[model samples]
Target: MPEPIIEIKDLTKDYEGKRAVDHLNLNINKGEIFGLLGPNGAGKTTVILMLLGLSEPTGGSIKISGYDSTTEPLKVKKITGYLPDQVGFYENRTGLENLLYTARLNGISGKRAYESAEKLLDIVGLREAKYKKTGIYSKGMKQRLGLADVLIKEPEIIILDEPTIGIDPKGINEFLDLIRKLSKDKGITVLLSSHLLHQVQKICDRVGLFVDGRLLAEGNIDEMAEKLFNNKEIAIKAQVSNITQDLIDDLKKIEGIRKVSYSGDWLIIKSIENVTPAIAKSIIAKGGSLYQLSYEKYGLDEIYQYYFEGGVRHD
Candidate 1:
């Protein structure tokens, strides 16, 4: 098997007395979209900076494409592209000029830079706005321009911090589609950092959750879903009469039932197995009318909560 494209061992970063990243460890395979998920101030930015060689790790090491970030920063940077959460562009420069300038900085120049600029603008949906001054462009357009700049070098790895932050609904969708295409067509490995769980859920092959400088959990969504919920949920609708607290309590006593709550006239319950039959039988046998009962499908939101509430800590 090919070696992993990105690897980190016992990574750490500190600012004065505070620890920004605490002994972090991560491995990203080639051509995979890896999500670094966490809430605000969870060391996401610190990790990205360390990975890109913008800040030196207080301890540990990082390797991109088999080149150590500490010992081989130049070679590592040559194959890496980064898009920051807040993009700052020259207001006076046109979209085409920005792309050409970036390409030139990467050793692409003259006709080659022009052609590359045009191609990247088209790829990022900025072809029509190529000549427009960035000052007058909308937030979404500026983001697209930033992406064009990042791709001008055709780097093997793309590190995006809050790639969809501040983008409108349509722009977010477009950017996501573009990322999928880049990964599939160009085979570029992506490290996406975002606070939004749903966006990570949509694009990540695997995700690592972090909190307060600690990695809480890391895995695929399906495995997380099963581990958190264990494939169990309960649904109960109003039977012949209105649902009561006593009836809810009685249903809770059934074997395998984990939690029971009321949703309007329906009783929501979660169980490990076929709980409907037992619940229905119990309700009818106890002289209470049976309205309806069925299995409930666990949602991602519910499962996500399980991780934060019950996740293992790595400190």
Candidate 2:
């Protein structure tokens, strides 16, 4: 396995006698989208700042690509890009102009900046609206422009804080797709921090769940589900015209089949593993016709609610 590009150990932060981030420890692998997920004031923003070298940690260590983020801020900043929850752009300036201006600020100007700005504008899908004044741009368009603004620096790591906040569902979907592309195509490590559970659940490769300044859990969805629910219970719902007590009895006899019940035409199943295939096969073997089978798998939202509701799970 590749080494982690960002590593945090015992990271803590305090503000005015309150602990904002507590003994935070986690890792972000290269070219992967790592989500720092939590509600507001969960220290997500503070962690982003520390990763970007914008703020100091009261204690602990942060290393980005082997450079100490606290002491070697210049080296860290050079490879990291940040987009705040609300990105600020000049309303009077055109999208193209905004990126070009930012490129110049990063010390790359003239033709090089123009080319880079134009390419990024195209990359973020804002090229058609590039010449228009950003004051007339919609919130989604502005968000895309903000993305292009950050990419002008050509940073290897991108930190986005609630990038989809206030975006329409369609826009949010598009933005998440763009994020996936950034990691796959550019090999850039992305740290997305947000309170929105479903959106984060959809795109993140791995996630660290934070609550009140501490990380409560960290892993992929399956791992999280295992940690939270002891191998998540899958509910398979099926519709069948033919019903039989014999069919129910046979399904219950199957190994690892936790439970089985039905209502009207809906056959509901509870299992540790996928029993849909077995159920369908049994339906065919019997005189029943399988009309429909749909299953629901547990994701971050379910596990999040479990922890958020104060339930504990064993490793």
Candidate 3:
């Protein structure tokens, strides 16, 4: 792989005698959509803040595109576009004006800033509302405007904190699509942080799960699932003449079956490896006629919950 676009080594942050982040280490490759996922106060925000040079690290180092953030902040900032959780905008300024003003702050000149603003507004689907005062914009529109402002500098890396927060479901879907396009088409490395596990599960190529101020697990969803819920789930639909609650209770007593839940005519059995055959035998002995039997693979949400509930530990 090309050298990592962002690297953190032993990164830690402390606030009021509490360690918000602890010995965090990770890497983001060039043009990859990496996700930082955790519950609130799980140290995700602190990691992003330190990476962006907006907060001081109590220990360790951060390197963005080979430039040390501690010593080369200006150079790093120049090539980074960051949108924090609370994206602020001047209520009185039009969306176009907000973008132009931010560009100027980044030292972009008049004509170029205007042109960039227009392009970004169109890119983010805000062209029709580009000249409207931001005060009148809805949450989703304001988010689009914030994203446009972040892109104004045309940075090499984009760090988004809870980018989909407070937006409607449709808006969230649109914003995620935009993020995918940015990484795939523009070759920009992205570090998207969010507490919405499902959203992160959908878009991220790889995800790092955090809890209690530490990274608990990190990997692709399928790998994580296999490592956590390796046996997978089995669903059986049956028509029974002699099956009873006693049979279900007896099946529950068998080893290897992790979970058994019924849905309409289906008995869903989640078990360890090779246990489905035993379940089948038990059902046959109970004289239940099987109508349908199938295996369904686990999704990212199930895998994430496995880690979140302390089923796996990173270190």
Tens-digit lDDT track for model 2 on 116-235?
998888888987999999999988988899898878899999999999998899999999999898888999999999988888889989988888888888998888777767666777
TM-score-sorted candidate list, best first: 3, 1, 2
Q: What is the lDDT of residue 102 in candidate 2?
A: 81
Better of 1 and 3 by TM-score: 3
lDDT tens digits, residue span 5-118, model 1: 999899988889899898888889899898988877889988988888888999999999988888788888889999899987888999898788888878889998999889
- Give all TM-scores, in the order shown: 0.85, 0.79, 0.88
Off by more than 4 A, model 1: 226-244, 262-268, 280-300, 309-315
**Whole-model lDDT values for every prediction:** 0.80, 0.87, 0.83
Candidate 3 lDDT, 1-315, residue by residue in tens: 467889989998889999899888898889888889887878888888888787899999999999988878889999999988888899998999889888998999789888988999999999999888999999998888888988899999999999999999999999999989888999989999998988897789888887767876678887766665545553334444455787788788888777677756678676654566677778888878766566556766666666677546655
Q: What RMSD, rounded to one decimal, does every model reach?
A: 3.4, 5.1, 3.0
